[model samples]
Target: MPAARESLLDAARTSLARRPWSTVRMVDVAALAGVSRQTLYNEFGGKDGLARSLVRRETDRYLAGAERALAEGGLPAAADWTVTRARENALLRAVLTGCWTEGLPAPAPTAAPSTSPVPAQRRADGPLPTPAEVIALVRDRAVAVLAPATSTAGARATLARDCEVALRLALSCLLAPAGDGGTAGLVREAVAPIPYGAGR
Candidate 1:
């Protein structure tokens, strides 16, 4: 079932590349996934369920990539990842920027499929985070990954602020690409803490 579910979502994403979600037929998605339409309904309950699941999967993947980027090189790397992914993934771009644009499915709250046998589908049907919520989630995730357990609350707060600065810069870079052709330098400069007592 998991495999079928994943395949369906993959097929849905591929179809989305060619057409709007509103026009995508369940039969086509099932055929593309090589499953019966019945199986599709059994898994997702309906098109709205599928759409919700698709958006959830996309956001989850994007955030996971952000976490990996953070682990590899902190905020600059994460910022770069965010910019790159937004450029390549339209759904993610919509999720981050609050612009659904034509052909992309916007995330929204949907009633959970109480009768769904698939737990994943039920979760997917739950209320989705808004673009603002996504921003907050990423900032918080950056803090959790960047700030260590030993760091004091004050230090963590400062780190969180830096994370927001980096995230905002990255988001802005997406809206307005840097003429310099990258996001890392901008994020690095924006988040770099001032040296203590430098003004003296």
Candidate 2:
């Protein structure tokens, strides 16, 4: 059942690349997924439900990338990875700002969803978080994940502050890509001062 739902979402995402979400149809997605229209409805309820699921799936992918980068050892590494991913994934940029624009072409139909385990279930009816809210969530999670690496109370406090700054720097570069030093250079410079903890 999970695989079937994933296939449907993949088809929907592929259709979205060629046209706006308003024009995407359930029949086409079902056909692409080799499932019946009823099955599609059963899986996602309707088009809006499907879209929300897609957004959540994409957001999860972005967060998974951030988690991996954080695991790579420090705040600077996390900043670099986050900036690079935002630049590469158009869906990430769109979800971050709640503003969709033409950016990178959508992934091919065969592309698979991220293999990272899904996080805790979210309420289906809640509205998606705004860009600022998303950043704050990231900041909080980063501090929680990285806090144990710090040896002193002062260093932990500083680490939390630096995580917030690093995320903001990455979001800034994503929103208005730097023309002079480039996004990577700018993000790295901003996060370079944060002390990295021993990998937990």
All-Cα superposition RMSD per candidate: 3.8, 7.2
lDDT of 2 by residue, 86-146 (tens): 6776677777766675432232222333222322112332456667777777666677677
Please give the clash total of every predicted structure, in order.
0, 0
Q: Please, what is the whole-model Cα lDDT of each candidate in the order they appear?
A: 0.82, 0.67
Instruction: Please give the RMSD of candidate 1 to the true structure.
Output: 3.8
| Stretches > 4 Å off in candidate 1 | 111-115, 194-200
C-alpha-based local distance difference test score of model 1: 0.82
* TM-score between candidate 1 and the true structure: 0.91
TM-score list, all predictions: 0.91, 0.77
Angstrom error of the Cα, residue 183, model 2: value is 3.4
lDDT of 1 by residue, 108-198 (tens): 5655445677899878877877777887888788778777678788877777777778788888998788667378878767766522111
Candidate 2 Cα deviation (angstroms), residue 193 = 2.6
Alpha-carbon lDDT of model 2: 0.67
